[model samples]
Target: MSYESITLATIAEKTSISRPSIYHYYDKKESVFVDLIIQEYREWGEQMGPLLERRCSQEQF
Candidate 1:
């Protein structure tokens, strides 16, 4: 979905969390999106870290 169309209600429904509970962690929808991106990056880094640490050749990489 486009960022412009995203609302707190949209996020709440998608996440199965209430709007009030969302407020406890974020003051606005943008904050939720920012946090989501940060979380995705962290997870991606964690998944790739071990593979990068392995002694694989460049071709295997």
Candidate 2:
């Protein structure tokens, strides 16, 4: 879904978290998106870091 269409209620419903609880952790819905982006990057690095460290010939690369 588009960012503009994402509401706090939508996020809460998707996560099964209450709106008040989400508010306790995030000032706004955008903050939750920022956290999600950071989490995705961290996970991506963890999955790709090992592959990047291994030696590979030009063709393999």
TM-score of each: 0.80, 0.81
- List the lowest-lDDT window of 10 residues for candidate 1: 19-28
lDDT of each: 0.91, 0.89
What are the RMSDs of all candidates, in order? Answer: 1.4, 1.6
lDDT of 1: 0.91
Error of 1 at 24 (Å): 1.9
Off by over 4 Å in 2: 58-61
Instruction: Summarize candidate 2's per-residue lDDT along 1-61 as a digit string, tens digits.
Output: 9989988888998999998988789887889989999999999999989878999888885
- The residue pairs found clashing in candidate 1 are none
Name the runs in model 1 displaced over 4 angstroms.
none
